[model samples]
Target: MKLLVVEDEKKLLENVAAFLERKGFLVDTAQDAEDGLDLALERNYDCIILDVILPGMGGYEFCRFLREEIGSDVPIIIITALGEIDSRIEGLKIGADDYLPKPFDLRELEARVRALIRRNQLRSEPVIRYGPLTYDSRSGVFSCSKKELSLTSRESSILELFLRNPGTVFSREEITDKIWETGFESRSNIVDVYIRYIRRKLEAAGILDIIQTVPRKGYGLRRLRDDG
Candidate 1:
C-alpha cells in the first residue's frame, strides 16, 4: 500500500514514515500542507495521513480541496492535537474518513490505517476479475478455477496493479515508480523479472497469455473473449 503523511513535526514525521515502511507500506512525507496537496494531486495513494495544524492551507481546507476540487475519494486519517469532539466532527465534515488524536500509539495508528484501507477496498473494488483469474486486493490472494496461486509480495502487488487496469499499458518506469520507493535504479530489470514470475504462475493455473507485452511500449492486460 502507498501512503502520504503530511505533518510538520520532523521527528514525528520520520518516526511515522519509518514505522509504516517497516510494516510494508510505500510512504511519502510532506512537512506542510502545500507539499502535501501537491503530492496528493500528483500521485495516487491508497490512504493519506493529514495533520490538522499546518503552516498554510491547513488540513481542513486541504481535505475540502481533495474532495471538492480533485474528487479524490481516498481515505484520509486526520491527525490533530485538538481532541475535542467538535474538532473531530469538523474534520469529518471536511471529508476525513477517520481521526487520530495527538500523542497516540503508533500501533493504533497502524490498525486504523489497515482498517480504513480494507474498508475502502471493499467499497471500491474488492475482487478484480480478469479472464478466469480472480484477485482479492484486500487479501493479496489470487485464485483461478477456485485454486489459489502462491505469490510473493512484489508479484502480488504487480498482479494487482495489472488486474485493476486491464488493457492499460504500464511502462517499465511507471511500474517501478508505483511499486518501489524513490532512489530505485531506473534501469533495473526488476519489473520484467516480476512480470515473468506472474506469467509463470498464471500459466501453471491453466491461464495463458493474459499479460501481453507491447513491444517497445510496455505490458498490458489482455481481455480475452472467452474469459467470461
Candidate 2:
C-alpha cells in the first residue's frame, strides 16, 4: 500500500518513512502541509499521516481543507504531541481515521497504518464490478460482458472518480481540480464534452447506463442496479 507521511520533525519523519518502507509499503514524505496537499492531490495514496504542528498550514486546517475543498475521501492519521482526550476527539471530529501522538512507538504506528490501509482498500477498489460492466483502473480498461471498450484519458479519470465516490455529488470545480492540474488552460465545455465522451464509450461497450446529472449540483455516478 502507498502512504504519505507529512511531518516537520526531520528525524521522526525519516524514521516513520523507513519503518513503513521496511514493512512493505510505498512511503512518501513531506515536511509541511503545502507539499503534503500537493502530493495528495497529484497522486492517490492509501493513507496520509499528517502532523499537527506544521509550519505553513497547520494540520487541523489542512484536514478540513482536504475534506471540504478537495472532496477527497483518502484516510488520514493525525500525529500530534497533545494526547489529551479532547485533542483526539477533535481530530476524529475533523475526519481523521486515526491519531498517533508524538513520541509514539514504531510498532504501534505500524499497526495503525496497516489497519488504515486495509480499511481504505476496502473503500477504494480499483476494479468495481457492477452487473455486466467492469471498471478496471490498473490497466485503464473498461468492458462489458462481451467486448472491450477504449476510453480517453479524461474519460477514464472521470469514470474512476465517479466509481470511487458513487452516489456523491461532485462540484464542477472539484472535477476540474482532479483532472486539470495547476496552469492548465481552462475551457467552459471541457467537463460537458468529457461527460459526452464517457457516455459514448459506455454506450459502445453496451454497459448499463448509470451516469447522471444532478441539475445544479454537478455530475454523479449512479449504479445500474442502484438507480434512485
Candidate 3:
C-alpha cells in the first residue's frame, strides 16, 4: 500500500517516512500542506497522514477541500499536537478518518494506518469484470478466458483502473499520476510500454481489441457487447 505523510518537522517527517517504508509501504512525504495537497490530488494513495498545523493551508482546511471541493474519499488521518476532544471532533467532522496526536507511538500509527486501509478496501468491490476480463482487486489477480494472467503489481493496478472506467480515455499524465510511483517521468512513453504489455497478454488469452488508444488523449478499455 502507498501512503502520503504531510508533516513540517523535518526529523518527524523523515522518521515517519522511513518507518513506514520499512513496514512495506510506498511512502511519500510533504513538508507542508500545499505540497501535500498537490500530491494528494496528483497520485492515488491508500491513506494520507496529515499534520493539522501546516505551513500554508491548514490540515482541517485541506481535509475539507479534498472531501467537499474535490470529492475525494481517500482516507485521511490528522496528526497534530492538539489532542483535545473538540479538536478530534472537528477533524472527524471535516472528514478525517482518524486523528493521531503528536508524540504518538509509531507502532500505534502503523496499526491505525493498516486498519484504515483495510476498512477502505472493504468498502470497494473486491472483484471487477469487463467483457472477458475478470479482476479480483483484493487478490490482484487478472484473468481472461478462464486463464489467470501473470502481471506485475503496477501492471495490475493500471489494468484495474481501465476496467473500473471503461470507455473513458485517460491521458498519459493521468495514468502516470495514478499508477506510477512519485517522481516518475510524466512525459515518458512508459505508459505506452505498459499498455503494450497488457495488450499482448490479453491477445495471448485470445482476447483482442479491448484496450483502445485515442489519438491524443491516451488509452481506455473498449466497450464490448457484453457490457451491460
Candidate 4:
C-alpha cells in the first residue's frame, strides 16, 4: 500500500515514514500542507495521513480540496492535537474518513489504515477480467486459464494498471512514475525488464497478444473480444 504523511514536525514525520516503511508500505512525507496537497494531486495513494495544524493550508482545507476540488475518493485520516468533539466533527464534515489525535498509537493508526483500505476495496470492483486472465485486486492475485500466475510485486502492479485501462498506451516514464513512486534513474531499464517478465508469464499461461507494444510509442493492452 502507498501512503502520504503530512506533518510539520520533522522528527515526527521521519519517525512515521520510517515506521510505515518498515511495515511494508510505500510512504512519502511532506513537512507542510502545500507539499502534501501537491503530492496527493499528482499521485495515487491508498491512504493519506494529514496533520490538522499546518503552516499555510490546514488539514481541513486540504481534505476539502481533495474531496471537493479533485474528486478523489482515496481515504483520508486526519491527525490533530485537538481531540474535542467539534474538532472531530469538523474533520469528518470536511471529508476525512478517520481522525487520530496527537500522540496516537502507531499500531492503532496502522489498524485504522488497513480497515479503511479494506472497506474501500470492498466498494470497488475486486476482480478485473480480460479474456481468460483475471486480476484480483483484493488478493493481488493474477490468474490465466484457471492457473495462478506467480508475479513479483512490480509485475502485478504493472499488469493491474494495464488490465484496468485496456488499449490505453502507457509510456515508460508513466509506468516508472506510477510503479516506482520515487523517480526512476535516467539509465534504468526496470520497466522493460518487468514487461518482459510479465510477457513471459502470460505466454507460459497460453495468453497471447494481450499486452501489445506500440511502435516507438509505449505499451498497451489489446482490446479483448467479448468471446475471448
Task: State which candidate has the highest lDDT.
Answer: 1
Q: What lDDT is obtained when candidate 4 is compared to the true structure?
A: 0.86
Q: Which ten residues in a row are the worst by lDDT in model 4?
A: 178-187
Better of 2 and 4 by lDDT: 4
* TM-score of every model versus the real structure: 0.64, 0.55, 0.58, 0.60
Error of 1 at 150 (Å): 14
lDDT of each: 0.88, 0.81, 0.87, 0.86
Write model 4 residue lDDT over 116-162, tens digit each, in one string.
97678657879878888988888889998668999998898889878
Please report the TM-score between candidate 2 and the true structure.
Answer: 0.55
> Which one is best on TM-score?
1
Candidate 4: stretches off by over 4 Å: 130-228
Candidate 1 Cα deviation (angstroms), residue 55: 0.7
| Candidates' RMSD to native | 7.4, 13.6, 9.0, 8.2
Q: Is candidate 3 or candidate 4 better by TM-score?
A: 4
Candidate 1 regions with alpha-carbon error over 4 angstroms: 135-228
Summing lDDT over every window of 10 consecutive residues in candidate 2, give the lowest-scoring window. 177-186
Off by over 4 Å in 3: 128-228
Candidate 3 residue pairs in backbone clash: none
- lDDT of each residue in 139-171, candidate 2, tens digit only: 668788856778777777787677766677676
Total clashes for model 4: 0
lDDT of 1 at 192: 88
